[model samples]
Target: MDRTESKHVFVIGLDDFNLAELQTVRNADEYEFHGLVDYDTMVHPPSYPMDAILAEARETLANAPAVDAIIGHWDFPTTSMLPILRREWGLPTPSLESVLYCENKYWNRLAGQEAVPECTPAFQGLDPYSDDPVGDLNMAYPFWLKPSVAFSSYLGFRIDDEQQYLQAMATIRDNIHVFAEPFDNILQYSANRAALPDHGSGATCIAEGLISGRLCTLEGYVHKGEVVVYAIVDSLRASNNVSFFSYQYPSHLPVGVRNRMISYADTILRHIGMDQSPFNMEFFWDEATDRLWLLEINPRISKSHCPIFQIATGASHHEVAIDIALGRKPNFPRNEGRFPIAGKFMPRVFGDTVVTRVPSREGIETLQKQHPELVVHVAVNEGDRLSTLRAQDSYSYEIADIFIGADSESALHDKFRHIMEVLDFRFSDVVPTNYN
Candidate 1:
C-alpha cells in the first residue's frame, strides 16, 4: 500500500478534540498528522491579533515538509481557509468561489433558490436596524430569525410573535459580532471545546425557531461535479427543545419520500456549484404537508455522522472523508448490501447544572454489556455544569451521545429509550435562593 509516502495532512482548528480524535484515527491508519492550526490558541491568549495568529499558522504549515492536504470539519469559515492554503502551497482544492458561496449563508440561500427553488425556505435579509424587522412576520408566524453569517445556531431564534422577533434581533446585535473579528477567532474557541469539553467552553450557532418536523441529514461525496449520497439519517431532537438529541439512520421515511429528499439535495448541491467535497445537508420533513424543506448545507462532515456509518454499514465516515480529501474513491462496497439502522442519542438537560447524583456507571456498563449492539459515548462527567438549550449552549455543556444499530426503526427507537432509562441524570441539590 506504500504507507510511507509521507502524506502530510494539516487539520486547522482542533478546538474541541474533534481534530484530536481524527488525528488519532488517521495515525492508526499510518498517515502522518503533520500539525494543527487553531484559533483557540489566539482567543484565550491575551494581546493576540489576527496577523500574529495567521503568521503562526503559516509558519506551522511552512515548516511541515511536503504537506499533502489541509482539512477541517464542523467549523465553516475556518474550514473555508482550505482554499487559501491550497493557493499558498499550490495544492489542489475546489474553487475559492465555491467555498465562499457555501460558507456564506446569504449567498448559499440565494444560489440554492436559483438552482433548487422548491427545497429552499422563504428567507430574507433584513437591516437589523432600519428595515421592517417584523414586516416579514407575515411571511410565516414562526419563521426563524438567523444571522446572515452565523454558525452552530448561536444567534438563531424562533420568533412566534412580534415581541420575540424584536428581542431576538436585539440579542443578535448585542452578542454576535461576526464581522468585527477575524473569522478564525470566532470559530477557534468552539473547535477547541469540541475536543476537550470538560476542560473549556464548547462551540455554538444561532437559529430561528425550527420548522417543526422530523430532522433528516444527508451525507455525500462529490467528485468532478457529481454528488453521490451515501446515507440519510433521521435525527431526534430534544423534546420541547431545538438542539439535536439523537440521529437514527436508515431514515424511517418511505422509499419514495427518501428519493424526493435526495432529489431536492441534488438540486441544491448542483445550484451551489459544489461539485467536489464532502457535504452534510440538513432538511426538515413536515408530515402534515408531506414536504421536505432544505435547512442548510455544511461543506464538511461533523463528528455526529461517525456512528451512523459505522453501525449501519461497517464503514467509517472519517475514513471516507479523508479519502475524498486526498482525491481517492471511498471504500463502501464491502458493506453495501443490507441497510442497517443506526442512531446517536445526544444528552438532554433540564437546567443549567445537573447537581443530582450522576447515572450509575455500573448500570450504564451493565446495559452496554447486555446490548453489545449499542455504542454509548457520554460527553459530560460528574459535577459538570450543564448549559442552556440555545445553540450557544453547545459552547456550555458537551453532550453525551449513544450510538446504536438495530434491525428496524422500532428496534432503534427501543434501544434509544433503554439508553435514556439507564443513563438519565437527576438533580439532588436544592435551588439556591439567589438563583434567577
Candidate 2:
C-alpha cells in the first residue's frame, strides 16, 4: 500500500516507551497516527487489569475507523487482544486459541512440556484448597512463585524456606484473585483470560527458580512458522541484588551458544503456535549445564532497547514489528551487524514514594552533556508514588530508567556507575507515618 493510502495505526499503550522514542513515533510521517487508549485508565490505581482493559479496548476499537493494524508496544493487555482484533477486523493473526495458550503460564507450561520436552521447567498446579497447599516440592529451594497470566515480575517471589513460603502465600492471598465473572458477556467477546477473584486481584503460579547465572533476551519476528532472530541483549544486574539493572547489546555469547539459543526459541515459538507475531523471549544461561533455559516469552517488542538497536543497526525493531503485524514483509537483515555495547539502567528505590530527595535534574543534565551519544529516559518525577518491583510487593518502588551506549562493555558499565554516583537517589530518611 502507498504511504498515504495506508490506514492509521492504533497504538494501545503509550506509557511504555521512553520520552524521545515515544515522541518520534507519535510524530512520524510513515503512517497516520491515531490517538492512544490508556488501557490502564479504568483499573483502580492505574495498574494493569487484563480483563477490564480488554473490555474497554473492544469498545474503543468499535468507535475508531478500521485500523490497518493494532500495535501493542509493551502492555500485557495489548498482547492479549491481538487475536481478538484480528478476528474483529478479519486481519491475519495467530489463532485465538494459540494466543490464549501462550498468555496463560498454566497452559504454556503444559504445552511447552509436551512440545519441547527438553525445554520445559519443573512446575505443578496449585489447588486453592488443599491440606498440603504448597503442592509438589519436586524442585529445590529458592523457587519462584509467580502468577499464571501476568507480567513485570508481578506476584512473583523467591522462596528460600518453609517460613518464606508461608509468608509469600499470605501475600499472594491478600493480593491476587481468580476472575470469576464471565468476560464474553461483558465485552461481547472472550477477551478475558482467568479472571481475578476480586477487583484489583490476580491469580498465582509458582515454580522452582532455575539456577540461572545470567539473563539474556532474544527479540524476533515469526512468519509462516519461521522465526527471524533480530537482536540478542545480555542483561546486566547488580552483583548483590536480584533486580535487573541494565542490558548490553551485541551479546558476548559464543557463536555456537547464540545459535543454540535461537534454536531453542524457535522450538518454543513453533510449539506454542506463535506463527504471526513479534516476540521477546527471555532465557537464563546455566553455567554448570552450559545450557539455556526459557524464562518467559513476551508477545511484543522489548521496550527500553529500541534505541539500542537503532544505534547498533540503522534499522528499528519497532518499525519492523509494525510492518510485520500489518502483513508487510519487513526488510530486516538476517545477519545483524554488531555495534557498540548499549546499556539501560533503571533507578532503584527503597520506599513507595520519593518522600526523600531523588535523582537531580542537574546531575542528569551533566551526564547528558558529558555523553551526548547516550539516550536516557527518566520515568519518575518528584512526589510520584513508585509501584512495586514485582506485582506482589505491598508497596511499589521503582524510580527511573537510564539508557546509555558505548564502545565496550567496560565503558558502558563505567558510564552507568558515574551517572548513578552523580544522580544519587536513595532512602536515607525515616519512612513518613502518613505516607500513602
Tens digit per residue, CA lDDT, model 2, 276-393: 7887877777767886777777777787677776556644467656776778656653334244566677655544544345666677777778877555555555555555333323
Candidate 1 lDDT tens digits, 307-425: 56666665557665667767776654246413477777765554466545566678778887877756566655666555532334432343466777778877767767766766665
Could you estimate the TM-score for every candidate? 0.79, 0.82
Q: Give the worst 10-residue stretch by lDDT in candidate 1.
A: 195-204
Candidate of highest TM-score: 2
- What lDDT score belongs to each candidate, Candidate 1 first? 0.62, 0.62
Per-prediction tally of clashes:
26, 14
For candidate 1, give the lDDT of residue 242.
72
lDDT for 435 in candidate 2 is 12
Q: List candidate 2 stretches off by more than 4 Å.
A: 1-6, 16-28, 39-55, 128-132, 135-140, 178-204, 333-339, 349-355, 360-363, 379-397, 429-436
